[model samples]
Target: MDHPPRIYCYRCRKPDLLCICADVTPVPTRFGIVILQHPQESRRTISTARIVSLSLTGARLFVGLDFAGCTALHSHLAAAPGPVYLVYPERGALDVVDVMAREHGWPDGAPTFVIIDGTWAQARKIKNQNPCLDRFERVSLSPGAPSRYRIRRQPRGHYLSTVEASVLLLSRLEGSEEAFRPLLEVFDRMIDRQLSFKSGESRRGVRRPAPRPEGG
Candidate 1:
């Protein structure tokens, strides 16, 4: 009889579903994260949402624009009186920088970040797909360090993987350099583990190795 099929950990790629090496500690914060993931991206095994969800307390991940199935996000926005800033670059005729500067002095409260979670091209598609989002103030981060996401290629320097952008924003807003450090570390470690696994699998002439026995 054939053995049960092996399953990879979605986040860590380990034979074990839950990796003990990965600490599931919590970060204390009140900031809310609104992740708008493209449908294709949402199903990928290595998407950044896994890390972002584990890192923040008020994190909400949504697959599309309608907000129909994303009840949590809808409720958050409906109840929130503060301004919502779409974290995307300004396109032709869409000047986010100007709006951000003008709304800087709003008396009510701090701004919430709405990140578009996809590649530069995919993100642009998201923006184009959702015209209702035109009114939101787009808060683009000035170009900086290159992304640490090794799997995907980005055009020139116009791209930042979602996690990198999140860390930068959190650092600037909350004044915490360590805001998303753990998540970044986890990502780096995951890459290293995946690379090692791939190298071994290549040598064995198989796509995947026999999984370690359960409780072994």
Candidate 2:
């Protein structure tokens, strides 16, 4: 059987041999990020967890629908020392006000952060299955600007992808909103590539859109 000549992933707009994904390294931060990703989200070609984990050295990524105590995530959580803050949206459950209040009351030290990397529904499941997480305070973001991530759109304006949420948390903890600028820039570039690939695939047979300018 003649298979169509293997489309080079770069040409096909998929992950190429030299794709940036392979070289992703973690960055250091005051808060450690433990991302529990849903298995489905892990398999996605456009997984944002990959982006965030790669960009942050202090970050660890785990993939699963539920944490069953036997999973690697259990070990990680068991080893975590600081207070864990769950990054989720929904005002009453966990919000900035709650964390800020705790931070003020604490006699010493900051908290460790646990961010769930999946759809809002999947994240809630993660929280429910991992009873240990309940011991930690849940964290919700302050109302903010719209998400820059285009591939997966959140129904609620306040909801953010895992990477965005992590970046926000780091920014607040480090006392410099600008610290996360590099992470966001890297994310923006990745999103742009995904968008470009989709556009090309959508118009495979139609007149090609003008290529982006050389500098971009």
Candidate 3:
């Protein structure tokens, strides 16, 4: 039997009925955002990297692995207006606030943030493979509220969604939490809509396929 045509939103790329495009309002930031997304993560329907890209002005999104050889990324890193930092939770990484307070104080221009978008293991792989990123200073977030991302199970409770992490970082950098509030609102709405869609499917008695056994 022929399936019904699926209508998708041109901007958000989600199904038309679940599109959150109207809720998106691009927020400006002094700091540049570079998102390196894993190929698998880019394909996830519930992934937030796209939303983060759309929400921040001048944000760059590059997909794939081994960015060490990416000339464009290397050029961007070289020409960044201020210090470049990788947003990962490495042992030696400084908290965002502490980084702002240290040594010469905040730089004249906003720092560039390199965020890896993927699962914890995938993120680790990206960091490991990209030797070029090793030169930049690493930064991490201070302990905050538990993650609001309910759709996916995080390896730990502290892990935030890509968008959540971006918003939190921006809030600290901008020194005004109010400015980045809309991004979180949009993210929350997206999650709620997805949950509603799943509920509808259940009500219609559409059974999800059972999980496949490993190595089966």
Candidate 4:
């Protein structure tokens, strides 16, 4: 039997047909971003955390559930030039836009936004397991447009992908949406390509073989 062809895009680490690296552009930002990604999310072909890291200059990506023992994370957090805030939707979390407005464009100082990249359950698990995250101020996004991550169905209508959340946060902080709009455009194109691939698979009508009888 002939093996399948291996055509991979080294930059994105995705198969050639699903690669979006050529369409991406890295944007500069005043605020720092730290993405704590669950190990499982990092392996997904459609993971947006990688896109987020690639799109933003100086953004950091760390993979794991427990960061309390991570000296790198501790050092990064400690060296942050300004305040550190966790982007989460916990009960006491404040709306990020509101927080920014009240401070008059981050008067306290530009913030280092830490985002947890994972599914809802995985994100919650990371938060629960990582004691180091407790030291940061928690922030949430105000109700806005619905998520455009069409390939994956979210449990709720309001839950945005990690990249979407990051884009919104950055747009709001900069007081203009144009800077981060390219990331959204890239995300949209990625979804469209994936959907087309799925449609092609459906048209091809690939099916599993039926089980044989126990008594042949």
Task: Give the better candidate number (2 or 4) by TM-score.
Answer: 4
| Tens-digit per-residue lDDT, 80-153, candidate 1 | 55678788766533243554466574567656678988767777887887765677766777646787877666
Q: What is the lDDT of residue 67 in candidate 3?
A: 85
Instruction: List candidate 3 stretches off by more than 4 Å.
Output: 103-108, 208-216
Assess each prediction's global lDDT (C-alpha) against the native. 0.67, 0.68, 0.86, 0.86
The clash count for each model shown is: 0, 4, 0, 0
Q: Put down candidate 2 lDDT per residue, 119-194, tens digits, no spaces.
A: 7777788778877777666677774788877877887887777778777777766767776776776677777776
lDDT of 4 by residue, 18-83 (tens): 898988898999899999999878867788887888889989999998887899988988888888
Candidate 3 residue-wise lDDT, 170-214, digit = tens: 898778989999888988898999899899989988776696784
RMSD of each: 6.6, 7.7, 2.3, 4.7
Residue-level lDDT for 28 in candidate 1: 55
Q: 36, model 3: CA deviation in Å?
A: 0.7
Residue 89, candidate 3: how far off, in angstroms?
0.6
Better of 2 and 3 by TM-score: 3
Angstrom error at residue 193, model 2: 0.8
